[model samples]
Target: MTTTRSLVVPLPDTTATCQARRRLDELVKPVGSLGRLEELAAWLCGAHGTVPPRPLDDVRVAVFAGDHGVSAAPPGAPGVSAYPRELTAAMVRVFQAGTSGVTVLAREVGARVRVLDIAVDAELDDVARDVVARKVRRGSGAIDVEDALTPGEAEQAFSVGRAVADEEVDAGADLLIPGDMGIGNSTVAAALVGASLGLPAHRVVGTGTGVDETGHAHKVAVVERALHRVEGRVADPFDRLTALGSACAAATAGFLVQAAVRSTPVVLDGVFSLAAALVARDIAPDAARWWLAGHRSTEPAQSVALTALGLEPILDLGLRLGEGSGAVQAVPVLRAARAVLADMGSLADLT
Candidate 1:
């Protein structure tokens, strides 16, 4: 009973992929000497439907920021997250200011960043107008005891994601990266993966933000409770999203789906993006074809979701940062792959 949507996700271009493989075989280096780089080049060629794959000059990293109610607690009391809830909005401002790690990394890779205020609890008055214009609500309800978003809000966030993809693609974004920003997003993201894979809380939960053993146990209990509440609707992707995920996650799902639909490639960050992409893949069927797991995350849910998607991460830096920093780090790897395909000397050149 997955959330069946009216959408058609196209497969990658086999002709271009085969062409890339053939050309890769002719590279002056030993056959397959480039190893995964060869595979990556072929993937790029397939995704772009071009023999050598076009340059990824206009890479856009979209950070979806939102607040999760599961992070709420009584005054002076702690909750699922180690950081204060207000940091979500603060980081959004940091992203807009172009000072965060994500911004720095994106700039180094010849890309740009866009920060969207999907559901941060704060007013974010200091942030740029365009950054906060897409707020879905003040924050999501606590998934441990209440629904994260209403049906309408879930759809709205998803639609916002699709619109963002369309906006970026229409504006000539050759590649897209969807990042996550929230205090307790890892918890919700793990829950999304659990629902998609029918796993228990212990199997899905992880030590997000270096929570202590006590904090880890509490987080597991909280996710367990949330899973219990959604047991009946686990089969419905949107229902699971509405009950256990946040506006950011839903928007990410939409963003990934629309990127695939538009035949644009995407680099997924960590577990946050993985969970959302899991739901996106379920809804759109073959959307995973347009994605690359940017890096391996410390979270087990990240590996779980990657395995489910049949995607192998490009890097394994143990990055737990969720601001799309990990994916941005892989931009250079993509550049290297594209370089080998576009610039490397071929055996035919020697002839």
Candidate 2:
């Protein structure tokens, strides 16, 4: 992540984290018997400033949908995705219809899904106002040849994300998940992370959406071109985002920044979310304390980014599908952490 202005994001409550660990150890079970569950519980405690974090009663996921210019080519071409570009808009409608994979999984975990059209190529005016109200442009520019977004569009996307986080937190969402929905967004994510971490294009590219070896190589070449375009020129996180990230990525980064400012805990989803998180962390170093690496994707760039942020994945399910599915899958595990802290009996209870 590029070093920028460190926002006044506060660290989690240390007293609460200590109390939570002590309480967990004093439980009726053996010390540390719960393994990582205890660690998750303690992190939640620090996030909420309480020994027993309030149950994750309200979980909200904001999927930022946009289209990439690099993906303008058809399938099997450089910078293009296996899926068609129309899938971005089609998936938005599917998400609103509650029939998407993420929606169904969200239902099982008692979480809510909200889709935002940040830079979708099509006019989603027919969708809910809340979703399309923040559209900065139709689609982002081809990063391989031009900046992904203009300076104005990048700023607007970031503002939209910050506003959405406030709206969710004000609506009583205790936990937030930022997901991505854009064709070829994986390429955009990799390019941004490659720029942020000063890595070569080959090191950051990954086969998103089940690409074959040839397709993966094509993606790598495309990302390499984009990274070369901005190498040694953009050092600020925001500048890197404008150079290499999609509209949805900038929005996700903004959403992450505001969540930390609001002291809301977040479960990061996939390479897309982690890519944004790396940028967000650069803007606010302390914001890392409020985020949990929801799951690890198969992307090599994701592991590198997560390690750079000092976050360990809660689950390594080999999940690559974005739209916050993996993060929501780990929500039940977090809920269990709260349950263990709130319901598991202690020796005092036995007495």
Q: Could you give candidate 2's per-residue lDDT for residues 163-269 as a string of tens digits? A: 89989999999999998899988898888889889999889888888778888988888888888888888788778888888789989998999899899999998
Evaluated at residue 69, the lDDT of candidate 1 is 93
Candidate 1: the clashing residue pairs are none
Count: clashes, candidate 1: 0
TM-score of 2: 0.96
Q: Give each model's whole-structure lDDT.
A: 0.90, 0.88
List the candidates' TM-scores in order.
0.96, 0.96
lDDT by residue (194-240, candidate 1, tens digit) is 88998889998899888888788988999999989888776767777
Summing lDDT over every window of 10 consecutive residues in candidate 2, give the lowest-scoring window.
Answer: 1-10
Measure candidate 1: CA RMSD: 1.9
**Which regions of candidate 1 are displaced past 4 Å?**
1-6, 75-78
The alpha-carbon lDDT assigned to residue 191 of candidate 2 equals 89
